[model samples]
Target chain A: GAGVSQSPSNKVTEKGKDVELRCDPISGHTALYWYRQSLGQGLEFLIYFQGNSAPDKSGLPSDRFSAERTGGSVSTLTIQRTQQEDSAVYLCASSLWGRNTEAFFGQGTRLTVV
Target chain B: GIQVEQSPPDLILQEGANSTLRCNFSDSVNNLQWFHQNPWGQLINLFYIPSGTKQNGRLSATTVATERYSLLYISSSQTTDSGVYFCAVDHYNNNDMRFGAGTRLTVKP
Candidate 1:
């Protein structure tokens, strides 16, 4: 089975620009999540979606950061007006459900704000 | 919100040796997971053991939910085991998981 996959493994953008990172979860896995990792901040959740229910966007750092999951399989994380501090590796993960389940992860999109 | 703490912070071991990593959480959790982030920035799920013990080849994990801690064991370690190991726990109904600082492991031949 294919594991979780992300697009644009690396992205470099100017400050105040918008960037979108995509994630494809594993087949039959309805639970998808996004996280960010950097030298200053450890791994932190960004959002999670279960089926079509409203996503848990509590982890999003600011209003400029948003994510959407479509068809309950693919998810896109968008960072609007990116800043230098936003530079980090955005990771995607998926599990079977919100219950006790193992989440598979993607290689992640390394975003660098210049 | 939940707080997770990993012990040792860093460890160095020779090939064929054994090591144990620990994770402690501040609150009760409904789910707990272990992950390994390689140098390539790939997050690999190691286990989803909220409770009990599970073993995969030379790697094993034990979670004592009552104690609010988990242990990951690696026996006969290899150079490939070098990486940062993290323990993340999701507080009940939080929908978001909190991760520990992680324990860095260095395997030397």
Candidate 2:
């Protein structure tokens, strides 16, 4: 709608349980990106979706992390069998295009795996 | 893959003072952006300068693409300006944005 919106601002999950984080990009934005930030760390690239193109998942740390964008608007990141290390803030951002454009970020989802 | 490095890992300034942050990249980039991460962990876009310079209120930024570096200037800093500043870049051939470790700014009253 206005800016990027992320669901479940904060989540607490069991060590081995799977968790899903959602993102709603701004209207008509064609590029969406997912990033992870650990405490006192820089933002780490996770995945990127540009329009209808195949997603770039090169930054995904492991097979346990996967994401999907529906209709090029909303995206969901699924972390399977979450580990304690997966606990961090997941941030979503969107831009009119992937290059030469400014990206707007959401408030992020804080995931805590115990 | 491009490498981004931000200098002066930490900075502390009195309100109304001025400060400058630096970001250096390893390769040519088509997109470069500056962001401010507030206390709540929200990223606020500051500048989208791949080259040249841009200004917004009390803040301004300059990028020398030829030199593979960018500079952020904060004039008249305020307590509310306390946060972490990051600079990100996208390689000319790729869209993946790489970010610097960031410079933490603490503006004191």
Candidate 3:
């Protein structure tokens, strides 16, 4: 992809529904990151992936929030049984390297639970 | 855990004005980044100033890693600069990144 791309630019779902958000990182980029922003993203680091290595989920708010990367190019974030509080803009980014590298972000998925 | 702080939680300036935003972290960092979130909520990377200074068009950033602070300078600002600016850093020992609440700038035309 030309840059980090996220699917379902905007989503509206009812409580208790499960929603899946997708992120396609830049080719050859090894690091993928996810962050959640409410009303706007407040810059909270949600999860990150470096190759096939286990993802760092320390920032996930709860078990309801989980993500997986297929191979190393694409990732998905699934929020199960969504709650009204789950409404937020979920962002995905990628970088050619690690922390020292600049990360490129997607437009983000705006999830709204009513 | 490392703490990140951004000064002037909120700012309003006229287009063509210049402003400086600051970020302070609690510990040594190998990585430091600045991002701008536009009205539509998209983050645009401004610089990777883990150390030293770098400039891109109207924006320039400097980080003194040893001192644990970074500064972002926006010169001849425009209405497009209106958005939230964030600073994020990784601890010397961790790969995880943490962020400050952010500085919201509103540039009026």
Candidate 4:
């Protein structure tokens, strides 16, 4: 992929339903990140992966929010028993192996919990 | 956790005017980036400046890592530039990349 790619660009789910968001990062990139942005809010870090291991999960808001990356290439974010307050945009980004590199973002998934 | 702060929470300017946005961090960072979120909600990377300065067309950025602050300058702004600009940073040896509240700019025609 030329850039980070996210699936289900828009999702409308009922309360208590489960939703899964996917991200396919650029080729050969080693670091991946997940973030959430509420309407008119700044990006909030959710999780970060260096390869298949998530080194930072301090930002995941609650137990219902979880994410996993496989093969060090694709990642999935799963929200269980979603709530109305969960409606927001989920963004994924990828960068090179180290902390000093630049990161690129995906188009994001807009989840609307109705 | 590192605290990131952006000044002038909101600004409105006429077309062709220039503006500067500032971002301050609570700790030294290994990576700093500027992003622009357009009206349709697309986040575009503007700069990946952790130190020194860089420019592209009408936009330029400067980050003084020693001072823990960065500045983004928009020259001859246009109506198309109306959107939210964000500054994100990753602290040294930390995997979390935190963002400031952002500076929302409105360029009037």
lDDT of each: 0.89, 0.96, 0.90, 0.92
Sorted by lDDT (best first), the order is 2, 4, 3, 1
DockQ of each: 0.76, 0.88, 0.74, 0.78
Tens-digit lDDT string for candidate 4 (A1-114): 889999989999999999999999999999999999999999988999997564588888999999888888899999999999999999999998848888989999999999
Write model 2 residue lDDT over A21-91, tens digit each, in one string. Answer: 99999999999999999999999999999999999999999999999999989999999999999999999
In the range B1-109, model 4's lDDT, one tens digit per residue, is 7899998899999999999999999998888999999998888999999899999999999999999999999999999999999999988757867899999999999
> How well is each residue in A1-114 modelled by candidate 3, as lDDT tens digits?
799999999999999999999999999999999988888447677898998788888889999999999988899999999999999899999988767787889999999999
Estimated TM-score for each candidate:
0.95, 0.98, 0.96, 0.97
Best by TM-score: 2
The B-chain TM-score of model 3 reads 0.96
Candidate achieving the largest lDDT: 2
lDDT of 2: 0.96
Query: Model 2, B1-109: lDDT tens per residue?
Result: 7899999999999999999999999998998999999999999999999999999999999999999999999999999999999999988766678899999999999
Native-referenced DockQ of model 1: 0.76
For residue A96, what is the lDDT in candidate 3?
84
TM-score of chain A of each: 0.95, 0.99, 0.96, 0.96
Candidate 3 lDDT by residue in tens digits, B1-109? 8889999999999999999999999888888999998888888888878999999998999999889999999999999899999998877666666788999999999
The better candidate by DockQ, 1 or 3, is: 1
Q: Please give, as one word, the docking class of candidate 3.
A: medium
